[model samples]
Target chain A: MNIDAVVDFNHWRDQARLLLQQGIHPTAVNWSGQQQTQLAFDSPPATAESSRAYAAGQVPKNFIKLARAAACYRDESRWALLYSLLWRLTHGESHLLHLVTDPEVKRLRHMAQAVRRDAHKMHAFVRFKKQQINDREWYVSWFEPSHLIVPDTADFFVKRFNTMNWSILTPDACAHWDQNRLQITPGVDQPNALIQGQMSDDMDKYWLQYYRHIFNPARLKTQAMQSEMPKKYWDNLPEAALINDLANGSGQRTQTMLDQAPNDPDRLRLKSKKLRQQQDAIRSKQYPSNSAPDQWMN
Target chain B: MQLMDKLAVLADAAKYDASCASSGTTRRDSAGGQGIGSAGGTGICHSYTPDGRCVSLLKVLFTNFCIYECSYCVNRASSQVRKARFSVAEVVKLTLDFYRRNYIEGLFLSSGIIQDEDHTMEQLTLVAKELRLKHGFKGYIHLKTIPDASPELLKEAGRYADRLSINIELPTQQSLKMLAPEKSIQGITTTMSRLQAGIDEAKSQRKNRQTISNRRSQATFNFAPAGQSSQMIIGADDSTDGTILQTSDRLYSQYRMRRVYYSAFSPIPDASSALPIQAPPLVREHRLYQADWLLRFYGFSTQEIVPTVGPEAGMLDLHIDPKLAWAIRHRDWFPINVNRAPLELLLRIPGIGARTAHKITRVRRHRRLRLADLQAMRVPLPKCRPFIETLDHTPAASLLEQDNLRRHFIPPVQQELDLFQAPPTPLVTAP
Candidate 1:
C-alpha cells in the first residue's frame, strides 16, 4: 500500500485500517505527507475509495487513543510508526501497547506526549482578539502550533468559551465555533488572510497593566517563566510586551524598595491623637488580647 | 475610589497567596447559560508573571480593609499600606473583563476582615454567587474561606466556588499566635474539618444522585469539585522544615487536603516588627516545593526528604534537588537495576522522575531497558548514572561511594541569558 500524505489522525486511522484489512505488512508500505508532491501509488493508494470495514475486532481502545494523539505529531515517520504498532498489536504481541519500555512503544508515547503538550500549550498561549465578523462580534486568535493539534484542541475552547463565537487560525489548520457546532478547515501555508480578523484590541491595556504590576521584582526568575511560557509565545501574548520592561526594572525596583527607610511609627503618632485613638479601638476589638483568637476572620 | 485604583491596592495585597489553581474543579461551561465563560480539564496558565508564577486566576482581595491585624499580612490593620474595597458587582465585572481578554482562567477571591465574619464571608460568597447564578459565569471561582464564617455560609460559598481555602498562616499554633494573634488555631482546624466533611458529602451526594438517574446537573451540584487547599508562611517564626512537614502531613492525613502552598516570608511594604527582616532564602521555598512533590507523587516520606547532614540541618539540601539529596544521604539503597527494579525503587533513583520511572517499568514488560532507552526518554543521565543499573551502563562502586559525589551532582551556577535580546524560538512547552 502507498499513500501521498496523511493530513490528520483520522486520515491516518482510515488508511491504516485499509492496509490492515488487505493484510499488507508495514515493510510493504511507503507513507509520506506534509508536502504537495504529485500522488504515485505502486498498486493503489491507501484510500477508502473502495474499502469496506476491516474485520479486526476493535483494536485496543487505549492504543487507538494513543495512536490518535501520536498522529498529531509532525514527525514524517509517525504514520509508519503507528502502522507498525497496529500491525504488531493484531499480528502477535497482544499487550504491546502496555509495554511502555519497548523502544517502539516508548517512541510512540514520546510522540503522544509531545502532541499532548502541544495541544495544552495551544490552549494556554492562543491570544484572542475581539473582531466584528458579519454583523456579530467574534473572538479570533492566530496561533502557531508546533504540530497538527488545532483539531485536537478545538473542543477545549468550545467547552471553555462556548457562550461566545470564536475561531482559532493556525498554519496547520483552523477551527471555528459558532455556538452550534465546530467547523474545521485545511491548512494554509501562510496566515495572511487569517490575520485580517483584528489588528488590535483595546482591553489589551488593562491586561498589559495587570502583567506589569503583577510581576514581583524581588523574585526574578526568567528561566522559570521562560520554561513554561517560552520566548516564542512572547510575540502574540498581549501581556508579553511587558516581559522585558518588568524584568529589567526588577533589580532597580527591588533596590529602591529596599533602600527606602522603614515607615516611621512617629508619623502615625503625629497624624493627630484622634487617628491613633481610632486605631487603638479597632485593634482592641480586632485582637481581643489575652483571650482565644476568634475562629473566623472575615 | 475608582475600581481600577481599588483593584491595584487589593490585588497587590492578595499577591502573597501562592496558589492560583483553577484545576480539579467540577467541570462547567456557559454553553447554555446567559453569560460567557467555561471551566474544565486541567487549568491553563493564561499568563506568567516575572516572579515565575503562573497567572492562572485573577487573584485579588475583595477588600484590604481589616480589623484583625495578622502581622505577616500587608493588609493588616496596623500596617501603613493603603486600603481599598471592591463591591461584589465590581469584582464580577473585572473577572468577566479579564476572562473576555484571555488574561486569566478564573478568579481567586480572598479578603481581610471587614465589619464581622458574617459580613465579610457574605461579601466574598456574594461575588461567587453573582458570577455563577447571575452572570452564568462558569469560570473557576476559588474562594479563600474565612475560618470564622458560619458553616451555612461556608457551604454556600462551596456551592458557587470550584475551590475554597483557609490560610493556616504559620506551622505551629505558637507561631500563628505570635505572628497572627487574631487568627485562632482551633478555629482554623475546625473550618478545615468542616470543609473536608462538606467536600466529602458533596462527592457521595453527587454519586448517589447520578445513580438515581438525575441529569448531568447532578454533576454540577454547585459543590466545590476542586476541594480545599491551604497556605502557610515560612520563616515568619522558628518552625523548622521538619516541623513544617509534620504539619503538612497532619493536614493531608486528617482532612485529605488537595494542596499545601509554602509561601516564603517575603518582605512587604510597612514591614512588621514581629517577623524576620529579610525574606527566607528562595532555595528554601524551592526545596519545600520539591519536598512537597516527593510527598505527593514520588511516595517519599517527609523524613526521608529532609534527612540531616547539610547546611541548615534537618532542612533540604539547597545545592541539589530534594530527590538527589535523598539519594545521596541514603546511598545504601543505590544501584537498583532499572531493567528489573520495582516502580517504587525506580522513583527513588536520583535522575529518574516519575514519568521516566513509569516509562521504564512499562516498557520493560516487553523488553529489558538499556542506557539508550533512558537517553531516548530524555532522562538526566549524569544524575541517575551513579544510582541505577541499566543494561548498557552501570556505575562503579567507587563512583557511587566517592566523597566528591555530591559535588558531581551539583549543577553549575547558570549564566543569565538576556531573553529580551534573543530571537524568539519556535515554541516553548507550558509546564
Candidate 2:
C-alpha cells in the first residue's frame, strides 16, 4: 500500500498525483493521516515527473474545490477516493464527476456534505463563555465536532467574532484567535484548557428561562429535534439541561392549560409583578452588591 | 418583573408567530468593525425545539401589553394574559449576550402596541438601533411593524432591521375585520407598499449606483435588505384554502414579499370565546406549506390548484400533494420523454423536484436515461413512472386509461406516509 504519512490535504494530493503519474492503481495505495514516513525508497516517488504527467490529465475545477474540502475530513478513506476519482478522470471516465448517481461519487458527495455540515454546526453550536484570563477578557468554548474541520471553518469565526479574543477546543484540533491572527494547534484528548463553569452567570439563567418558555408543548417531535441537533451536541449546550424537564413537564402543563377555563380573565401580569418584586428583593438581600464577575446585564 | 421572568412572559406571548427564518439578508460581518456579530447568507439554527421548529433567531415580544382588543391575540387588551415589557437597554444586552453564547442567530423583536402603533414601532426600532450602533452587532434583526406606524418610523426601522414583517393575521379582509377589529386591510397593504418601495429603492440604488471610489452615494440607504414578509393565521377564520392561496399569490406578486408564513392557530391559555375553540390539524398546516411551494416553484396558479368548480372545489387534495393532484387531473400531458423534455414539462411530473429536473437535463447530455438512472437519482418512481417516459421505461398501456390508477397509488388510511415510499428495485429494468 502506497501510504502517504501526512495529515495535510495538499501533501496527500501531491503524493496522489505522483502515484497517478507512475500509473499506481487505487487498490495498490493505502492513504493514511498517520505521521510516519517510510524509508527513502518507499517514500513518495520523484515529484519532477508528476508535474508533466498531471498536465495531460484535466481535472474539473469543481472536483478540485470538492476534493479540497473532502480532503480536510478526518476519514483516511477520502484520500484514496479522491485519488481513484483523479485516476479515472485522467485515464478513462472524463465525465465521471457529473454522474452523481454513481455509488462511488455518491459516497464522496455524502462525505463532502458531512464536512460542510460539520463546519456549519461549528459556526452554530460553539457556546462561548467570557472569562477574565490574565485580566483580559476572553471567550472560550469546547466543541466536539464529528470531523476534522477546524482549519477550514476557523475563518468564518475570525470574520464574525474578530473583536473578541476566543479559543475553540475540540478533540482533533484547537483554534485560537487574538485581534491580529489565528493560531491552530494539535488538540488534546480532553478540554482541560477550557473552564467549565465560573462564567455561566445570570445571563445563562435567563437563557434557560427563554429556552423553557419558547418551546411549544402541543407539538412535540423529539425525533426531529434530535435529528437536527444530535445527542452528542446536547451535552455542551446550556439549554440542553432543560430539554428533559421541559419535555417531561410539557404534557402536565398542556393538560392544566386545557383543564383551566379558557375564557377566564387572568390578568396576572400586573398582579404577579408584586410577587416577582418580593422575590427580587429577597434575591438582593441574599447576595450583596459586591459580587465577583459582575451582573451579566451589561 | 425580573429580566428572566419578563423574557419568559414575552417569549411565551411571541411563540404564536411562526416565522423563524434568519436568512436572505445582505451579507456582512464584524470584520474590522468594533463589534461582535455577523449576518447574511444562510441562517443557522443553533437549537431545535421538541415541536420540530428551529430556534434560529431569538424570537421574543418586546412587551406583551396591547391597547388593541384583537380577540385572537392572547396579549390583546381584552385578554387577561400576563404582560411584561423590556426596556430598550435590556433587550440590547439580552440579544448580545445570547448571540455571544451562540444560542441564537439574532433578535426578532416584536411588540404588542402599548399606547399607539408608532410608539410600539419606535420601541422595536430602538432595540435594533442600539444592537447595531452601541454594540456594532452585524447580526440579523427582524422587526415587526404595525400598520398605523408612521412612515418615518418604518423608514427608521428599515434602516436597522434586516427584515420587517406585519402579520396579516387572517386570509380575507372580512374575517380580519370580524376577528381583529382594530386592524384595517388598507393600512396593512399600505405598509406593505411602503416596505416594497423602500426595498426596491435600496436594490436599485445598489445596482445602478454611480460608483464613486467603489461605494454608493450616502443618499441610498440600506433598507431591509432581506425585505418584508407576512403571516396568515389559518383556521382562525372561515376562509377556505382558495382564499388563502389567492391572498398569498397577491402578496407575493404585489408586495414582493419574501415569505407569507402560515401559522396554524395555536391554542393559548385564557383563550377568547370569539375564536374557534379547536386549533386546526397540524397536517393542514403542512399541506398548505406544500401547496405554497407548488405555487412559488411549480408554476401552479391558485385557480388551477383549488379547482374553480367542482365538489372538491376551493380545497386542496389532502390525500395526495397538490402537484400530484394537478398532474392527475391533466393526464393528457403525461408520458413526456425524460431524455428530451424541457424543464417546465419535467416539473409538471409529480415526483421530479427542481433539483432532479435540472439534474436530468444535465445527465441526459452524456447518455440516454433509463428507469434505473431515474431510480438512482431517487425520483419517486411510484408517483412518476406513469407520467414519464425514459429509454427503457413504459407504463402499462391501459394504466393511464384505468380509473383505478389513482387509487392504486393511494395508501390505505393507516399509512399516512406510504404514498412517499421509495420503490424497492427492478420494477422496470433497463434494456
Candidate 3:
C-alpha cells in the first residue's frame, strides 16, 4: 500500500498509527515521501471496527522521541526504519531498542544523531547580519542545513532572542521572530537587498580583528581547526578568509618572536611606570572612582 | 586607542589563557527580560581559531597593564607590549553585540593588575553586574579572580558571574615566587577555598529553598553556578608531568575545580631570558589533558599514569595516548571478555570509552555480544583487536605476550617527528 508524501513527523506519525492499527506489516506498506499514489493497496483500508491494538501511550516514550527526530532526517529510508522499529517494539520484541547492535535500530539511532548534529551546527554557524527595516532593527541570516530541522530548532532562537527581531533563512524553510511571535515560512533562494548590502558592516570587521589576534601562532594546528569548523562552512564565515594567510605565516611569526632580543628589565620597568602614571591621570578625570555611585553593589 | 585597535591588542594579550569553556551553568534564557541572550547546560563553539582552540566566549583582558613582573606573562610590567583597557560600558556593549550576532557564547573578561587587587576585581565584577542586573542578560560570564582581592569583592563576583578562576601560574610555591614575585601559593589557595565555600553554601541554600517551597523558583541566589576552574603553565618552570598531575588531582578532589587547563608556554613578543628559549611540544599538552580526563572520569590515580620507577618515568609517552600507554605497561589486565566485564573493567580496555562501555554493558544484557556486534557499534577494531575478546573472536595468546606491542600502536617515524618532535631533554626535565 502507498500513502501521500509525509511532510513532517506529525504527518508521518498520524499515517503510521493508522497502518499499525490496521495490523499491516512494515514490509507490506511502502513509505514514500514523493508523489502520492491512487487508493490501491494489497491490504484493506484502515477500519474503525478494528480494535486499537497499539495506542499512542502503549509505545515507549523513548521510541516516540527518537522517531520524531529520526523522521526529520533527509534520507528516504528513514520512514521505513522508524516503522520497522515501531513494529518490532510492539510485536513481542519490546526490548529491541536496547540491542544497539541490531541493524534496524542502529540505523534509526544514526539518523537521529545526524539530525541532532545538523541542528547543533545550525545553532553554531548561523551568522546574523543586522539591518534597519522601517526604522526598526532586524537580524537576518542565511544558512544551508543538511536536514529538515528549521522548525525543530526554532524555539531555541525564540527563547534566546525574544526581545529582538530576527529571521533565519534556509534553502528548505525559514524562521522569523518579531518581539511578539515566531513565524516559519517557505525558504528563500537569496537574502534581500538590505541584508546583502550590510554584509561587511562594522560588526564583521570587529569580529575579523578579534579572530586574527586571538590565535597563537606559536601553536599552529590547522587539522584541529578544520576538523571542528569544516571547509564546507567557510564560505559563509568572514573570519575563515584569514585562516590560510594566518596559517601560512605562522612559522615566520614564531621565528620572529623567538629571534628577538630580550628587553632590558630596568628600562622596561621605567617605561611601564611612566605609562601607568599617564593612564591613571586620564582615567581619574573620566571615571572619578570615589564619586561614582555603587548602585551595582548588592 | 580606537576600539578596534584595543580589541586586537587586548585579545592578543589574552591568548595565553587556555580556558574557553562556557558550559555547566544554571540554564537560563531571556524570555521576559529586556535582553537577548541564553545559556544552557551545553556550551556552543561559535568558531574555531587556526590554533585549533575553540572560540566559545569572547575571551579578552579588560586591561593589559600589570603592576607585577611575572617573567612568563606577556602583559607583565617588565614586558614591552602595547597596553589597552576597556571601559565597563565598552565591554558590556561588545558582549551584547557579539551575543546578538551569535558570534560567541558570552564574555570571558580577565584583566591585569591596573591599580590593586581589590580595584581590579571590582572592575571585573562590575561588568558581570551590569550584564546580569542592569540588562537582565542570561548569557555565560567567567571572571578571573585576583588572589589578594577582598572577600567582599569575591563574594560579589560569585553572585553575578557563572564561573570564576584564578591561575595557579606554576606548580609549586618556589617556582611561583621565582617567576611571579607578587603572587603566592597560599594566597591563591585561600581565595579558591573561599570561593568553593560560597559555591557550596549557595547550592545548599538553593536546595533547601526548593524543598521548603516545593518548587524551583527563579529568585534563588546563585553563586558561580558553573563552579570554578583554574589554569597552570606547563613548560614555564621545572615541573614534571607527575607533579602537574598531582597538583590537578588535589585541585579536583579538594577545591572541587570543574577543570584544570594545562597551557604549554608559547613564545611571547618580548623574550624572557629567565625562561626556556623554545616552547614545549604541543603533544605534551594534549597528553596531559588526556591523562587529566583519566583522573577525573576513569578512576585512575596520578601515580598509575606516571609511575616512579620506569624508563619513561615522570613523563607521558608522546608517541601514544596515555590510555594505551597505561594498557601497554599493564598487559596482565588484557583480553577481558566484553560480554561479561563490568563497566569499570570495560572502561579499562584501551579502545573503549565511557559511553561505549556503558553501551556494551547494556547491549550485553539482551544477548551475547559477538565480533560483528562491536563493529556495528563503530568500535575501532585495529586498536581493540588484541585487548578485547568477544564470543566469536579471541586474540591469540602470543599477541598479548609480545614484547613489541607498543611499537604496533606508535605511528611511523617521520610522522612522529613531524607532529610531536620531542624537545631537548634538559629543557623539559625537572632539575
Candidate 2 chain B, run of 10 with poorest lDDT: B422-431
True contacts kept of 1: 0.40
Query: What CAPRI-style quality would you assign to candidate 2?
Result: acceptable
lDDT by residue (A1-298, candidate 1, tens digit) is: 4576787787888888877776677777879654443433446544333333455465788888888899888889999999899878876687887776578888998899889988888878887788787999898788889888888789888877877788888777889989889999976653554445346776676667666656677888898999999888776787887888889988887777666555533354356575556445543444234223332221
Give per-residue CA lDDT, model 3, range B219-331, as digits (tens): 87779999999999988897889888988887888789999999999899996777777678788899999999999888889998875665567888776778888887888
TM-score of the candidate numbered 2?
A: 0.88
Give each prediction's DockQ, rounded to 2 decimals.
Answer: 0.35, 0.26, 0.39
- The clash number for model 3 is 0
Top candidate, metric DockQ:
3
**Lowest summed-lDDT stretch of 10 residues in model 3 chain A?**
A289-298
**Residue-level lDDT tens digits of model 1 in B280-385:** 7787788888888888899998778876444445566656788987787788998899988789888898878898888777778777778877877788787788
lDDT of 3 by residue, A1-298 (tens): 7866778888888888878878777776778745566544555554434434778777889899889999889988788788878878887788888899888888888889989888888888988889887898888888888899999999999888889899998889999998888899998887655345555446988999999999999999999999989898886777898999999999999999999997654455465667556434433332223321232111
Considering summed lDDT, which 10 consecutive residues are worst modelled in model 3 chain B? B422-431
TM-score of every candidate: 0.87, 0.88, 0.93
